[model samples]
Target: MEVRWDIFLIILGSALVTFLPRVLPLMVLSRMELPDWGIRWLNYVPISVMAALVGQELLLHDGQLAPLFTNLELMAAIPTFLVAIMTRSLLGTVVAGMISIMILRYFL
Candidate 1:
């Protein structure tokens, strides 16, 4: 077997680049105490990111804003959002979303 040093170095460098941004913050922040407001604000980050992703997927088509009335994914999202809000269960929300999309696709 031949080992390609160039390919190996590229893979190692890519891994370092990918890993440092994620780990460096944790390493630096672990020793520092965050303020209560800072921690509270940080709690919204995950949901904000998730909303951005979901909103983009649901509301856009071909890089343009999709019509809300005619979009099948948007229709499916109605029940999925309700299930997520009501149950607050990740597994149930996922299952509900999957089922909602499946039914909407199958019927319409």
Candidate 2:
């Protein structure tokens, strides 16, 4: 069978396109300082992103709108929030959340 060089070239091109932006920042000049507001808000970015991801995953079951508190995700979030506030660590929150969710899942 003949090798598909065209497909290989397309895959290689797609890979480079995906990688360029990720590598570009690392290749650029010295450490840059974000503005004061940016610096202040940077810490919240991860939590915000986490919240969005968790929210989407929790609220969207079977590709349809669902009730909030009537789900595993929302139920797990309570313990996760308390753990995060108590521990003040992302890993701790994640672990706590996962454990709670898994235990709940196991039971029901």
Candidate 3:
């Protein structure tokens, strides 16, 4: 099949638009020296956001507060948390969570 230049250009432009914001920060910050507090906060931000997102996704529904006992996601998270605390490995946590979810879903 022949390549369409117009379609390629549109895709390329959209790709550039999406990538520029993300690439620009790293490109600009690569040579800049960030303060200690800035670096510390940056390091923690990912973990904090991940925790919030995971908690929200598992426990909340429709932007409202929900109970954990009746929620499958939250129910699955329980085993995941226990394994994570005991094992301290991402792989183990993920596997435990997925398996728990599958078992729960299958039995329910």
Best-fitting candidate, scored by lDDT: 1
Residue range 1-108, candidate 1, lDDT tens digits: 999999999999999999999999999889899999989999999989989999999999999999887899999999998998999999999999999999988998
Residue 107 displacement in candidate 3 (angstroms): 2.6
Rank order (by lDDT, best first): 1, 3, 2
Q: How big is the RMSD of model 2?
A: 3.2
TM-scores for the candidates? 0.92, 0.68, 0.81
lDDT of 3 by residue, 5-55 (tens): 999999999999999999999998998999999999899988999998898
lDDT preference between candidates 2 and 3, better one: 3
What's model 2's TM-score?
Answer: 0.68
Each model's backbone clash number: 0, 0, 0
All models, RMSD in angstroms? 1.2, 3.2, 2.1
Error of 2 at 13 (Å): 1.2
Instruction: Score residue 31 of candidate 2 by CA lDDT.
Output: 68
Model 1 lDDT on a 0 to 1 scale: 0.95
* lDDT for residue 101 in candidate 2, whole number 0-100: 93
